[model samples]
Target: MVARSLLALCLAAVAAAHGDHGEQKIIAGPLQSLWYNRLPGDGGTQADSVFSGISTFGRLPYLPCLSHKDITYDIAFIGAPFDTGTSYRPGARFGPSGIRQGSRRLNLYGGYNVPLETNPFNSWATVIDCGDIPVTSYDNTYALHQIEEGHYSILSRSPATDADKKGPSLQGKTLPRVITLGGDHTITLPLLRSINRAYGPVTVIHFDSHLDTWRPKVFGGSPSEVASVNHGTYFYHAAQEGLLRNDSNIHAGIRTTLSGPSDYENDGYCGFEIVEAREIDTIGTDGIIKKIRDRVGTENPVYLSLDIDTLDPAFAPATGTPETGGWSTRELRTILRGLDGINLVAADIVEVAPAYDTNAELTTMAAADALYEIMSIMVKKGPLSGLEVEAGDDL
Candidate 1:
């Protein structure tokens, strides 16, 4: 056995040295006796191994649309690639594709292993990539409505059958917990609209560099010239729609230059408490976690929206509104890891503009890493065996 093993190892090394060429897949010649598979990008095809057919957010199946009756999912991954509302940078429109491309190299099975013990995909539930919504351009009103309609269509058929009222609160539940890849932060507004229709008001856990509650930051006439519907003011509208539980809603990692004195007061009026970017250092990671947990509480359903700019420009410089000083990716990951067992109904990771990313795609990769962490948190939400049971009913 020892001699045979040695011989096999020698043959494997020789085959590896030969390099992959043409349409060859198997280890040819002297290496023919062994079976060594490669990853998707390991010189073979787009479809290979466990990583085959990978999609954004992770190696999830890409469904043409989420409304497919044959397949029911516990999680849905969708993209919103419209970025006309971006105030500074215009390329967030490509964020979805960039984030997706950046995730191609990552292992989807327990991709977030450092923070958790298990791969959510391995034991928890099922997930599907619902593809991207073809958001309308130019017409901000139609664009938002299109986004809202797309989200609503998915929520209308989603499994979250129950609604929660207070902290650590959960009503009844189904799956298809939505995870959106963004065109920009404005996507959150329409997304909240969909969530409100299905699950009612939820606690919004916002991670971003800006407060995003400025009502007069519109592009027209003056601050309040046109409707306050840009990427900068979605939370204000969400508040007006009563889609959020204002007091329970919280913002983390804010480092933006506030427009005026009332910015803080305005955010408070919108029903949100602010956690400045520097607070991460002042409060420490654990302290920040404690504050977030304490503020959001455990009763109500929660919706988490992460803007990649929450990280400092040094780590994530591709966002429209990059902040000079902010939390490190490690700190953010630690904070997210600590948020286990929260009744998280849905989440989104937005503003990864690859156009301005490093050659290594540090910004997009950071966003991907965050998405994986969120998946780990979802794993802690108890075994989703019920989702499987529910999905089986149709068969």
Candidate 2:
């Protein structure tokens, strides 16, 4: 009887506590306004360009080349939706769609934390969703050509007539830049070709688990066969083609088990520096940042190629060749923030294979978030030009 009475008293106390703190529910209409009205029901009709998925990057106006009579933008967001190059997993071909879907709330559309320093989506940066390049998965050589040509088409477009950094894209400078939504890391080589046309041979800041500098295999009298070309060997081709500066090129967060000593020896021969994934824990993100900045410096234009597998499988499980241990998402964000002031010419975030993703679309969501940071770097215009974040002192 004494125990029963005590239990009853405890239940009564819990009920009382709940009653004391219980709050009234907020009405939906007012709630939407406070959050930029970017919720599903808050959207305008699909036909409404203002509210359409193709028109905005996250509730920000999308402004595709077809939407306006003056179809020019400062930055072109292009998608290379071909995953045929993937060696292990086969779903990165869906990277663009997955990334764009996850990008729904990223802009002012109830997105979390808009940078007070600069808004890349606003009038200051004319960003266009150039849509995906149609690559026939069967033809690897043609697909690569299509990818390169797609970038060229966008790059060749005159920048918004007025690229006023202070105003809207219609008024900003014609600094035509392209950000590729990758099907795989191989997409970077094609993208590098286009960027090099715009800004000479660039210093590449490669973020991945593998060196990606493997030599190409010649097949059936032609090296151009799709089978001969793969996601792993593009960096090697890039160096030989003079598309990327060999000496200053660097690879970060790599933790893959190399096939042989010659593998790393080849990477070194290709003029690439590797920052092992374990080093993130040892040198810390700050140390990694200093090393990257030191390597790229201020002279050479930089191209950043990020393979999602560089992140630990725990944080990014949906990549093609996921390694066991790698950098966490937080570490990547911090490192990217540190690179704010570096001269960024072009970039891509690849290897997001959603087949292995969580039900919550975690991998796709991470890809979107990583793309957001990459866009933020572009908005800042150059290294040290963005969000004035202080460097962490830990190594």
Candidate 3:
């Protein structure tokens, strides 16, 4: 009887602690008029604080770009989270989410980019963060196809703004641009292939510490073709497959040790003009900008691929391969800002391995800021025009 009485008292206390599970009324305070019908701060929801909500790139709205054909956007941020192609460290598979986490503070205070004078989020374009591609870790070939198809799906769509239709287009329609959060440098091959279908061949502005145009036999002999496709040699495959425009592509910040002078010869044959990292000391950022602009020119559709390791280990130590002497974050951002009028179609920032990042998230934050600059430029210059999308091109 005593035990039963104690159990009854405990049950009563638990119920009281739980309280009523119903719609409870919120007491309107003295300042209720300020927020009565209006949404909370920044006009976002009451529960839409950056620290609490589902994280997307820049905390932008999420859309299933692949599944939904009806929802059109001008710019879409997509994640390709596969790192099997990495030659050195391997945590870049989580690069997409890590970049999103680092981008939380973007546009939080105010979505304005003063340098280029364009606000991507609030501009004429409809921007959305399309969630990552569902790439399988078990199969590299499958993952490659997945990333390519996901990119093409977004690239082939017409922009939400009908006014953008007057711009240059190979498809005869103004298509939306994609800013891909990368898995590794190897992802560039499929991206180029997709871009080829949309715009015959594009100038590549590659920023990295190493030349990625190594022949598979030169990089390391692979037993199979699939095995040969890796971060270091994808550009070789891209060149062989005719995804690049000759005499226009350029590589910046290259300081990696090469096998021999033949490697530089091979890089040149692949249609890339090299700008060594040490050149920044003499040429300055402006010189580097002039070289890139001169090489890429003002007409052709250009693809900008920035590997996080292009920054020195001191600034971006979390990447797969860190070189000691590289461009500072500010220097790289300044270079990017200078390429404002070029026809930049689609771009990617790859090799950001957040597992190797410091508590400060230096690498991921730097990558995010670099992307912010790229976004600003793309917004400043609308959809790429004057190119024709080659039809029925085999990949």
Candidate 4:
């Protein structure tokens, strides 16, 4: 038996070598004689046959428009390819394409035994990749309006009973979770608006280098006024509009500088917990997780907004805004992984501009990987399962 096994292993190795070269190599060993199997690539087909018919790595199904019937998927991935709102960089509008290309090599199944396909209920949940949202050219107002419309369309038809035909109104169905791939951080404004209209109030997990609370920075009457609607001050608008409740609903990560204190503390503004790089370094990932849970609560609906600049510039330099010191990628991953109990309702990865990247690959990859980490959590924990309450439960 041992000799037969050794002969089989040797024949398999030889077959692999021949297949790599697009050639056919037959073996006439005793093992082959007993099995009577055909030689590798003996059918005159291309040697790439082994990989044919399989889905491309990370290439998810694309459904651009959302109808009432298509809300069964647990998560919908949408891309926002606009970046005119960037404060420091000008090319983030290309973020979605770059991230898609970068993520081409990642498999849907977990890599290295990670089991990413498993869901919170121990059953696989449907995750669909909706294509990028169409953005108007060089107009932040138009772009914001477009994204808002798109999100509302999805939310309106989110809970469909039939997978083939459009179902009745979602008067009693759950909404589909929306995961956006952003052109820049500014896109979050409209997204937040849509969520606020639907869910009332939700916690925001913001990862960035700057506080992004400059209200007047781009408010002047100039061509740049539209630019004010960009990424640097999105959170300011969200808080000012009462989307983010001023008490413990917002958590800022890796903050190195404040855009301005008054911007954060003005009357009627929502309160937020800013976790500076110094504090994160001191308390570590475990402590940060505890703090986040304490503030957002384990069951509250949460939105995760990750800007690639939250990582140290050394590791993620492809962003339009790169800070000198910030959290490491591994540390950020650990923090995200630890949030398994938090109900992640919606999420986005923004500010990835490939033009600023020397490698043209790292920034989008970082964003895509961060997105994957979030998706893995959603799959494992189910969409806000632990956070949602029964209809009769007390608030």
Candidate 5:
């Protein structure tokens, strides 16, 4: 009874907090207007220009893209939409669409002092939701190769159209800004490989219940085992390939399980620096931010990967793996917000399997909220410079 009462109180508090806008009006101008009431059909031509720049996923305005062509996208929200890599359950491929559906209801004008929705910072930026990358196969390996090849092709600037020559050319034009929606964690392998080629090494902010560094051999097969490369061993392969600088570069959250100690020792794994959700509660969000900053440095390019299971089952239950002790939505938001100054290059929100969620609430909300946080950060950081979307003027 006490627990139920506490939950009720917490819900009430959140509602009150969200509703306490006081006199803050819902200004609806161009979706870009700073003033609260600039509705979409306002008379200003600039408003239409701004609206056209913004991309929509389902109903919510996703990343804004300036153009689309030559496979160029400043912020491509590609949906992997396949979870075959998962060892425990299958269904994360549904994540992208679910998230897009949920995002439709989100208000573009964030209230209060939220930095992402503010003007000046957001005015010059171009973010876009390029929709899902087309994948014809359900087979994990085939799908991964397709994803890798597709990104490689899109990023390459070489004039060669032949498959043989195109391979090397595509490698040359890889953009630095991309946000992939996952079929599962394993998909990150190809995505990271693409990013590594473009930006070199990067630090990863991994939020999940497991370290995800276990080798496929530990699970009784070689790394080539499709199941091994699935959600469980992506980081392991990344580390082996020298993508991560060290274990310190990978900061994990809410880890309560391990493949074993031998795996940690053999590779000089530093282990998760931060463990236990309660520790976050005690040290406070700012403290966690400081820890991340200290490790990755303020200027190092960082990638954030959020596994929905990182949130407590109560808040995000539609995941292949659900862990009890984890972060709440508010806590996760605080953490992302605190990392504002860091050089976040690319990010992904994964492992949201909506089929398991009858209400479609868990994966949907988590995915949209995660993207919102990432977009918030990007808007504050300024235009990704050379990585603009490639679309005809008609878009």
Candidate 6:
């Protein structure tokens, strides 16, 4: 029996060397592999599931829109990894990546948005992730300019949608929209500047636990002009820069303690009507939604900026500032859905500091899902206003 086993082993080795084993045939067509089974580009193969591939927002195609002007997309996700402006926390600079990581499962369940009755990722719009803007950690002035220029670079591109398409635009051309992932709330100032260049002045729907319109002086003035722009004071600068539409913009979910009553007065002067966090208890989500819709109207371009801290800390703890008694995740999602037909030109989800989050990654996940809702509304109401696109203007 031992001699028979040895002879069989020798024969098997000889058959393996000759690539001819009984009942084990090799298939011919290109070596019969799964490696080439993917769609075009680096989007990974069909075998590479959600948890494995590169993390782009919603697992969308990552295009470097800044340099690749030829590639047209209807909507883009750009990350602003600048958190130097945070007063309470310093780690939100990583918010962009954290938000992207949280967004890994966004398209996992077939990318359907049931409430809006549409699938944004598979709709008429061509969505892509433009990666993150290169921001400097040392210099605020140059960093802000980089952010503004980076945002404008993407904003000025020709959209994949047709010129005659019903969507946002400027200068008689079809323009694309962007959803910015926060480095911190300070990035909004530069973003507003970029948006102002595209659409004259837009009404802002500011959702946060604190009113961000605090004057630099009120917020304990910064030594330099660039230093003056923090998460708490960007809206003030935005107002001063004429980027905000007066009496039309609104701030919801405010619950933070202020230095004095003058803070509210100043917030008003900065062109915002406050909807305090406590009001959700009395008026309910629909009432809050009505207030936002009424204040923002449906005609003009609207920029919705949502800070993660807008949700109660229990729901989203990984933010620069956490305030109690904020809206629940469900309530905020409902409110966002209520703004379905509004002319949402651009929007942002900011202040997702993953370092402070629980092991469940609650904050970044909430931010990503909120952005999903925002994208749903944006896609549902395809640039209802007939503004034209800007052809590569970086002003």
lDDT per model vs. reference:
0.71, 0.68, 0.82, 0.64, 0.60, 0.81
For model 5, residues 200-260, the per-residue Cα lDDT tens digits are: 5567878777667776787536646666776777887787776664545645465556666
Q: What is the per-residue lDDT of model 6 for residues 256-356, given as tens digits with 9 covering 90 to 100?
A: 99999999999888889989989988999989999999998887778999999999999999998899898889999999899988888889888999999
Location of the lowest summed lDDT over 10 successive residues in candidate 5:
160-169
lDDT of 1 at 46: 33
Candidate 1 lDDT, tens digit per residue, 155-188?
Answer: 5553422222111212234545778888888899
lDDT tens digits, residue span 269-387, model 4: 55677677667768988888777778777655677888889888777888887888788888888888877767777888888888877665777777777777787787666533334
Q: How should the candidates be ordered by lDDT, best one leading?
A: 3, 6, 1, 2, 4, 5
TM-score of 2: 0.77
Q: In model 6, what lDDT does residue 150 have?
A: 94
lDDT of 2: 0.68
Q: Write the per-residue lDDT of candidate 2 for residues 239-283, one digit (tens) a residue.
A: 888887667878999887766778888888778888998997788
Q: What is the lDDT of candidate 5?
A: 0.60
Of candidate 3, the 10-residue stretch with the lowest lDDT total is 29-38
Backbone Cα, N, C clashes tallied per candidate: 12, 16, 6, 5, 25, 9
Q: After best superposition, candidate 6 residue 144: deviation in angstroms? A: 0.4
Candidate 5: residue 392 Cα off by (Å) = 32
Higher-ranked by lDDT: 4 or 5: 4
What's model 3's TM-score? 0.86
TM-score of each: 0.79, 0.77, 0.86, 0.76, 0.73, 0.86
- Rank by TM-score (best first): 3, 6, 1, 2, 4, 5
Error of 5 at 129 (Å): 1.3
